[model samples]
Target: MSASVTKMVPAAVILFGAMGLGGCATKSYVREQIAPVSQRVDALEAKLNETDGTAKSALSQAQAASGQAQNNGQRLDQLNARVDGIEQRMAESQKKKPRN
Candidate 1:
């Protein structure tokens, strides 16, 4: 048991020493890494805002186009009805005229 303790003590001391050195290096590296990620996050936010604006514009245009289509359909229906009425009148007039 004494021999085992002697071996473990040295290993524990070495491990603790290595961890202490690693802790200092890790802090500086983490700080450097965080800066770029923070900048990228800001850039992503700007892009998202731009996308949202474009989507809103497209939606407004689509709504306007849909309204125009409906108006045009009604106008077409009215024009077709007028043409039918004119054709009917011409057919009656032809029947009344004598054969030529």
Candidate 2:
């Protein structure tokens, strides 16, 4: 009975030892598991940088367009004033003419 009990204890120890090792992850295995997630995070960071640059460029373009629109509005106002002066001069000339 003692001999059988000793053999069973050794067998139990080996089985439990193997199971414990199986449950623990190795470094390479852990790295493999995390590789895809790390790649996705890196890709997202790159996209964020790209979007930031594009947004800055778009903002500058919008500012330039707004400035051009303001300049055009000023020119239009000046042109209207010149047209008014011309009409006023023509009216004065007509009034000065002899009655027809």
Candidate 3:
């Protein structure tokens, strides 16, 4: 019995050691598999950040354009008003002139 038990203990120890080694190998393989995915996620996040910056820049440009348009509209309105005043003065002068 003692001889058999001794042989069994060595065999069991070797088997358990092999199992531990296999577990470590599996962990390494899992890490390898996830590495590419992690890199892709990081790249996507960077792209998203760039897109956000572009959106903000576009919004700022749009606001500046809107402000310029408003200024142009006000200037146009003032010009129209001036033209109307000139026309009214010309009409009044024509009425006061002697008939031909």
Which candidate number has the best lDDT? Answer: 2
Looking at candidate 1, what is the lDDT of residue 4?
A: 94
User: Which residue pairs of candidate 2 clash?
Assistant: none
Compared with the true structure, model 2 gives a TM-score of 0.70
Model 3 residue 65 CA deviation (Å) reads: 0.3
lDDT of each: 0.96, 0.98, 0.96
CA error at residue 77 for candidate 2, angstroms: 0.8
Q: Give the per-residue lDDT of model 2 (tens digit) for 5-98.
A: 9999999999999999889999999999999999999999999999999999999999999999999999999999999999999999999999
Q: Which pairs, if any, clash in model 1? A: none
Better of 2 and 3 by lDDT: 2
Instruction: Using TM-score, rank the candidates from best to worst.
Output: 1, 2, 3
List the candidate 2 regions with Cα displacement exceeding 4 Å. 1-24
Question: lDDT by residue for model 1 over 1-100, one digit each (tens)?
Answer: 6999999999999999999987775767888989999999999999999999999999999999999999999999999999999999999999999997
Residue-pair clashes per candidate, as listed? 0, 0, 0
lDDT of 2: 0.98
